[model samples]
Target: MNALIFPGQGSQKLNMMKDFYDEYPQAREVMHRACDVLNFDLKGLIFGNDEHELTKTYNAQPALLTTSMMVFEVIKSKGINFDVVAGHSLGEYSALVAAGVLSFDDAIRAVRLRGELMENAVPSGAGSMMAILGLSPEKIEEIVGNLNGVYIANYNSPLQTVVSGEVTALLSAVDIFKNAGAKRVVQLNVSGPFHSPLMAPAKEKLSEFINKIEFRRPNVPVVFNVTGKVAGTLEEMRMNLINQLTSPVRWTESVKTMDEMCVNKYIEVGSGNVLCGLVKKIVNAEVYSTDSIDEMDKLEGVVKNAEIAEF
Candidate 1:
């Protein structure tokens, strides 16, 4: 079986999806629709020279979603399909669109608002996130169990767990993690304390927006970030999305669940290979990422080879 995954923030880059925009009309349509929804020149912002503006949370969210969807559409046009789907953080919105749970227009608008809300949730420099490498999740959890104002934001992989909290707590945890034999603990250059209790305000605001949008049943099962399980119903999927803003992304567990389900291949259809790298650490599956035209052209043969190997 095969699973399709999408990347989240930190995978975005300037000129992302430009090849699709230039070569495929369907891809260009996705970009134009995003521009119309957000009422801005999204194409310029994404493919233009201004890296700083494109990196902002609000811009990055919509841009990444658009790029991922553009890639997805191009691949779908070529008759590619998957048995299940999953995404990380902001990438979940893109996954929903791919699964037919949310329309591209609604997702683009919602993610724009979602980004703005998350960016403004905490005061600048008041909260932060850090990646703690070379530590087991259990050990890291035990170390931060008694600590206040700090929370695990992402269970990315066995060796990479991210923690988010107030600036003071984050700085303090750095020393404690090092002392606990962590290979490295470095702060992330994010706009806010995402996927933490600090994002409660953003979640609250986002819930209202989510309530307004119509969520249809997904065409395929979608593994959720909050629960690391397959969302069986639309209502459950909606709630999981709202809670995901303030819950740690159970990426490792989600991938493990797919592996347990006999998903032997993973295709990351997005801007970067970040999720592919993480999936590699979780399972010994055949993983491929298609972010550009050249990569997309090679995906069919790759999937075909994997299928032959499986049989």
Candidate 2:
């Protein structure tokens, strides 16, 4: 089996899905729907807007979702399919859409509301997220445990982990980790600290919003970030998505779990190569990524070869 993974934030770029939008009328229609649902000209921002403005959490959330969906439409149009799917952080929603568990309209609206809520999750400057390289997430957790505050936010990969909480507590923990022989510590440029208790406000609001929306079982199971396991039921999917805001993203665990399930190839159906690079490190398996129909065509032979090898 193979898993098709989606990337999260820090993977977006200007005009990221322009190729798809240009090639497919359906892809353009998706963008039009997003613009109507958002009441903002996302097409303009995505195609041509100020770089810094689009980086805002509110804009980034929807932008990433639309782009991922654009690429997804292109691939599905080509008849490419997957056995399982998973995504990192915000990308989880993209995975859900890809799996046919959520409609584009609902997903777009939910993420729009989600972004606005997350923007106010914590008071600006009250909390932050820091990336610590060259240390296991467990080691980082140990350091956070011994500190006054702060906590693990994202277990991105084996070597990259993020810690979030009060800035003071986080900085102090960073000092301790740095002194303890960590290779590097970098602060992220985010308004609110996510994937930590700092996002309680966002979680509360999102829960209410989620309850109003409808979700169905996915065509294929998705490995959730919060649980690091496959979500098989609608209730489980809802609960996991509700908790995802304030829960650490178990990316490494999810990737490994897919590998253990015999997922030997990974196809990233979205903007960046970040997830593909991480998969290469985690499983040492064949990985593919595409941003356009033309690019996706190149993978047809590769997927075919992999299927033959399995047989």
Candidate 3:
């Protein structure tokens, strides 16, 4: 079975899927449609030279969503079928759209507001995230357990765990982790401490917005980052998206859930293979990405062979 995984915030880059956008009419339409809904120069932000503007949380979230959907359209045009889907952090919106649980316009608008709410949740420079490498989650948890303001944000893998909190407290905890023999503790360049308690206010406001959007049952199973498993009902899925703001992303367990579902192939349907690389760390599965035409063609061949084998 094949699982389609979408990447989140940090996976974005300049002119993501621009080549596919130029070559594929379906991909082009996705971009054009996003431009209409966003009512701003989204292409300009993504394809432009202003790094600061492109990197802003509000801009980057919507841009990544649009690009992922563009890649999804291209993959669909090729007649590929993914049995399941999942995404990291902001990428969940893309997965939702892919599963037919949310419309593209709703997703775009939701993420734009999500980014803004998250951005203003805390004062600039007050919150931060750091990746603690080469450490078990339990070990990191035990070490930072009592440290006020420091909380685990992403259980990325057995080898990597991200912690977020007040900047000074986060920095202080970093020194503690480094001393505890962590391989490396590098601070992330994010504007706010996402997926942490600091986002409680954001979660409240987003809940009201989410209540207004219509949600449908997912056509395919969608592994959630909050629970690392598929939601049982549409209401649960909606609540999960809202609670995700203040919850740590259970990525490692999410991958394991797909493994349990016998999903042997993982196609990263986004501009970058950030999620692909993460999956490699967790499961022994064939991986592919839609980052380029060559990759997509290769994935199509793989899908063709699988279909032939089944026949």
Candidate 4:
């Protein structure tokens, strides 16, 4: 079987979908609609030269979603499909659109608000996130067990776990993890503490917005972040999305679950290969990324061979 995955934050770059936006009418239509929905120069923000503005949380969320959906639209035009789909963090919104659970316009609008809420959830510099490498989840949990305000935010891979919390607690935990034999601990450049208890406010605020938008059952299963399981119903999917704001992303477990389901191929259809790298660490499967035109051309052959092999 084959699974399609989408990337989240930390994957955005200026001119990520410039080629598609300039060459394909479908991609250009999606970008135009996104700009109309957000009432901002999303096209310029994404394909323009201003890297600083494009990196902001609010801009990055919608921009990445637009790019991913543009790629998905292009892929769909080729008559390709998948057995299941999954996404990391902000990428989940894109996955929903691909699965027909949410319309592209609704997702674009929702993510814009979601980003704003998350960015303003806590005061700037008051909270932070750090990637702890070369440490087991259990060992990292043991070290963070007694630490106040610090919590695991992302179970990225066996060797990479991210922790988020107050700035002071994160700084203290960094030293403790390094002393406890961590290979490296690096702080992430983010606006707020995401996927942790500190995002409760964002969750509460986003709930109102989510309640207003309509959600439909996915045509294909979507491995969610909160439980690392497929949401069996629309209500379950909705609740999982709500809880995802304040819950650690079980990316490692999600990939493992996909493997257990006999998915032998993973195709990342987004802006970067970040998820491709993480999925490689978790599963021994054929991984491909389709972020650019050249990569998309290569994916056609990969998909055809995988289909012939009955993967």
Candidate 5:
């Protein structure tokens, strides 16, 4: 089986989809629609906007959504079928959109507002995130327990977990983890601490927004970030999405669950090969990214080969 995966923030780069936008008229139209919906020059931002402008939370969120959706639309127009879909963090919204649980408009609006809420949830410089490498989630949690206000935010893999919370708490935890044989503990450059109690305000606000929106049953099972389980109902998916703001992203667990379900091929459907690299680390499979037209062609070839093997 094939699992379609999407990337989160921090994977974007300038000129990410320039080739596709130039080559595919449909992609260009979708990009234009996104710019109008967002009331900003999204196409310009991805290709010509300054680096600093592209990094803003509000812009990054919607930009990624547009790019991911554009790629999905291209693939879907070709009549592809995916057994299941999953995404990391912000990519969850993209997965939801692809799964048909949320419309493209609603997903874009929700994510834009989500980014704002997360950015404003905590006072500037009060909280932060740090990546702890070379340690299991359990060991990271053990260290988190020793720190006052730090919490595991993104359980990325067996050897990678991002901790978030009060800066003091994170710093202290980093110190102990380094002494305990961690390979590296690097602080992230982020506006606020995400996926922790620091995001409670954001969670509250996003929950209200989510309740006001309509959710439909997904076309394909989406492994949720909060639960790492396939959600079959709109209500369950909505609650899981709302809770995701304040809960750690169980990405590693989700990958493992997909593998157990026989999803051996994972195609990342957006910018950068970050998720592709992680899939390589987590499981033995063919990982592909749809970042460029060439990559997209490569992915289609892989899918065709998979079909041939099945026959």
Candidate 6:
């Protein structure tokens, strides 16, 4: 079976979907709808010269959603389909949209508020996230389990893990992590400490906003980040999304769960090939990413080949 995966933050780049927007009416329609829902000229910000503004938490959320949807529309039009869907962090919203669990309009608006709330969750310079290379997330968790203000944010891979916490705790834990065995500890350039206790306020506010929206059962099942498993029920899906705000992303486990579900092919439906790389490392699946027109052309051949192999 095949699964559609979506990437979250750290995968966005300037004018990412510009080619799609130019080449396909479906892609252009997605962007136009985003602009209407957002009530702002996202096209100007994304295609414009101000890249810094495009990457802001508030802006990036909707922009990524629109771009992912653009690619999704193009692929779906080409008859490409999937059995399940999953996403990383903010990418989860994109996944939800793909699964038909949430409408794009509701998702874009909610994530915009989610972004704003997360941006102001903690004071600037107070919260931060960092990547720990060549370290097991379990070992990293063992070392920082008792540390105040420090929490594991993403279980990205066997060799890569992310930590989020207060600046003071982050700085102090950096040395501890390095001394404990991390080969490299690089700080992430994100605005706030997401997926941690530090985001409680953001979670509270986002929950209030998201809960008001009705969540329908997905057309296809979704692998949630918190449990690294498929959602159990409709309310479970909604609850997982709200709980995701302050919970770590179990990316590695989620991929493993998908693998066990007989998903042998993965198509990353978003900007960069970040999720593709991560999926490759986790499983021996045929991984594909669609972020440009050329990649979309290549995807036609891939889907054909896969159908032949299945036949």
lDDT of 1 at 145: 96
lDDT of 2 by residue, 1-311 (tens): 77889888778788887988998887898899899988999999989968887888888989999988887777677667689999899899899998888888888888888888988877778888899999877788778888765878888888899988888887777678888778999999877788987788899999998888889878887899998999777998999999999899999999998998888879888787888988886778888888656667778777667668969
Quantify all predictions' global Cα lDDT against the true fold: 0.91, 0.85, 0.93, 0.91, 0.87, 0.91
User: Which segments of model 3 are wrong by more than 4 Å?
Assistant: none
> On residues 1-311, what C-alpha lDDT tens digit does candidate 5 reach at each position?
88889898888779888887888777887799888777878888889859888887777888898898888888887766798999999999999999889988888889889988987899889999999889888887887887779888998988888998998777767669998889999999887899998899899989999999989888888999999999867889999999999999999889988999999779888898889888877878778788888888987887787689989
Model 3 lDDT-worst window of ten? 44-53
lDDT per residue (tens digit) for residues 1-311 in model 3: 88999999988888888888889999889888889998988987788888888888999999999999999998888999889999999999999999999999999999999999999999999998999999899999898788999999999988999999999998888778988889999999999999999999999999999999999988899999899999999999999999999999999999999999999999998788888888999999999989988898899998999899999
lDDT of 6 by residue, 98-146 (tens): 9999999999999899989999999988999999998877789898887
Winner by lDDT between candidate 4 and candidate 2 = 4
Clashing pairs in 1: none
Model 2's C-alpha root-mean-square deviation from the true structure amounts to 1.7
Give the lowest summed-lDDT range of ten residues in model 5: 167-176
* RMSD each, Å: 1.3, 1.7, 0.9, 1.3, 1.2, 0.9
TM-score of each: 0.97, 0.95, 0.98, 0.97, 0.97, 0.98
Comparing 1 and 6 by TM-score, which wins? Answer: 6
Q: What TM-score number comes out for model 5?
A: 0.97
lDDT for model 5: 0.87
Error of 2 at 225 (Å): 0.5
Model with the higher TM-score, candidate 2 or 3: 3
Per-residue lDDT tens digits of candidate 1, residues 1-311?
88989999889898888988899999999889889888999998888899889889999999999999999988888877798999999988988999999999999988999999999999988998999999999999998898999999999999999999999999988989998889999999998899998999999999998988899988988999999999988889899999999999999999999998999889898798999999999999988888788888788888667668969
Residue-wise lDDT of candidate 4 within 119-177, one digit each (tens)? 99999989989999999999999998989999999999999999999999898777899
Off by over 4 Å in 1: 305-311
